[model samples]
Target: MPRADRFLSIRRDPLSDEVLARGGDPEAHSLLQRTGFVPVARAHETYHRVPTNLAERDEARLATEAVGRLRSAGYHVDCEGDFDTDHRPVHYLPLGASVAHIAERIREATTTDEVADALTDLTAAHDGVLAAVDEVLVALADFHEGLGDTADPHIARRLRYLAEERLGVITSDLSHTRNALADRHAPHPGRSTCTEQVPSNERERSAVCACPPPPRTLPAPPPPPVAAAMRR
Candidate 1:
């Protein structure tokens, strides 16, 4: 069975231009640089604490806005959380189907032919996800370019950086998947005495000698915090 590669977790933040320009809030600006900026409604209470109910509603609205932003940017919205202990809502948007699902298909394959087919399917799935990420980068670039001189330089820089980072991850994942498949399909140096030599093609190889082992499950990482708001 083929193990799943670790998925990238993206944190989104919604920040206002005013907050970015504020003198004492480097944290907000730093978050914007790291996660890219989304538009969020202004908080009414600058000094005083906001009421609990109002805070929760605001967070919920932010999460919904984030989901929409991601979709518009060309990502598949898997699911989202309501609110955390900090009263912040974080959304989980996977690029495609879970790696676990692909792993399950690999594990269930009982013959060499089946395993080979599963590997092909997994490779194709990975390619599709990489393509989706590329589409998102193109869309973001188009949007940024459309803004021309009116675009905020800081926001434009952060968006470009985020897009590059995503492309790097997707490209790396594709390389890793390709290497793993190659290792799996490579011919062994020595022949086993107990069994006849299997065919060169992976599909025709002997099941006992060529079938992949059960994939090891990696522990899922902690959810990323909500960095900012996505404005509607």
Candidate 2:
């Protein structure tokens, strides 16, 4: 397994007697060896827009609960869906972003200072959530951007970097992202072949990038009105 630098390693099985002594499983022990687990709560696989049937009620409740927990923990979760793909009818992004919730806060805020306070709260929630759990950074990035339009320079730069530069959210379908990257950047001045694909948990994995970090995320704003509302 790669070194556990930033993220903690989840072990299915205990490796040492001391671990087993502490009630860690010894048999069937295996580490989640993906040294690079992406912040994947918002992955297309785990989400559903709104569970509709009674059988799904618990899952729906859990989903909302998860969102609440993530918000409390400091992740900036956002909802996204595509017309295609039943798997991702809706999912949360728990990362840095620049739209929707933040924008709405800006609009609803009574004063310019209020906007600043609101953004601070939103970002605090984001960073706090990511302190232990990094999986929700994707959608959370944009929650305060007002349902999708934000003025955060961080979000703006990331969006510009991806939409225009063609980075992140790369395709997993037959490795199209790799191919496209290779075609565009492989021959660039002093750049290597585009062989390194951005993993799904794209941001944290970039800490070791040979180049500067790609704009998968920017810092988030805050959430003061939210705190005030809660205090009431």
Candidate 3:
């Protein structure tokens, strides 16, 4: 038989065969069964070919696994079938970091400097999410334009609604957080600590008393709104 044919002909041994091979060792047989191990042909067959349909299915399974990982790491992804020339679906994931944790950190901040640092970090994270949103939107718009009437009219409409309604609300919340922080840190005029008085030891002599200004207390910033839907 040709090498490929021989490979294709090779099959796994039956469970009964496995049990008979380990006849005296019931524990070992049980172990094998428990592990679901299937005995395969020992002959090396390098030309074995998998059916194209099976290969495509495995590719799709792997892509789905990859997208799951990306989402776990805080990304926004959209995947659909027939995205590539080879008919393999492509993922349209965007790069964005979660800001929910940042909000919690800001809430836990004890000092003004800590709060300021948290605000800065939150700003950066928000910007990153916004940039990712913009990229996805632009890409979708271009795709829609390219397809014109050939594209499903509802597809673009739904995407636009998500981008505007969902993402817009997130951006607005971020702006509110920024404004609250800015207001908390804004400086205000206060009474001075310097005073002048006549010296008791020398009636004609005048002395200036310079007292250190009391520490200014900053009002606590309003809690940042939680973005449960925008976890990624």
Best by TM-score: 3
Winner of 2 and 3 under TM-score: 3
Taking all chains together, the TM-score of candidate 1 against the true structure is 0.30
- Model 3 local distance difference test score: 0.45
Ten contiguous residues minimizing lDDT sum, candidate 3: 3-12
TM-score of each: 0.30, 0.16, 0.34
142-193 per-residue lDDT for model 2 (tens digits): 4534555555657745544553334223212213432344344223343333
Task: Evaluate all candidate structures by whole-model CA lDDT and list the values in order.
Answer: 0.44, 0.34, 0.45
Residue 208, model 3: Cα distance from true site in angstroms: 36
lDDT of 3 by residue, 1-232 (tens): 2222111111112552111111112222222232232333235522112123345455444444433443343333344442112322233332222555666766666544455556665445546546567568867965776575855566777777777788778767875676576557532223222445544665545435434446999999999999788565
Q: Write the per-residue lDDT of candidate 1 for residues 1-232, one digit (tens) a residue.
A: 3112111112222542111111113332232232333423357411111123344456455444434443344333333354112322344434334754656765665444445555554445446445555667667766776575765555666666766786667666755765565557543333212344455775854455653445999999989987888899
Q: Give the clash total for candidate 1.
A: 8
Compare candidates 2 and 3 on lDDT and give the better one. 3
Q: In terms of TM-score, which candidate is stronger, 1 or 2?
A: 1
Error of 1 at 191 (Å): 21
- Scored against the true structure, residue 165 in model 3 reaches a CA lDDT of 85
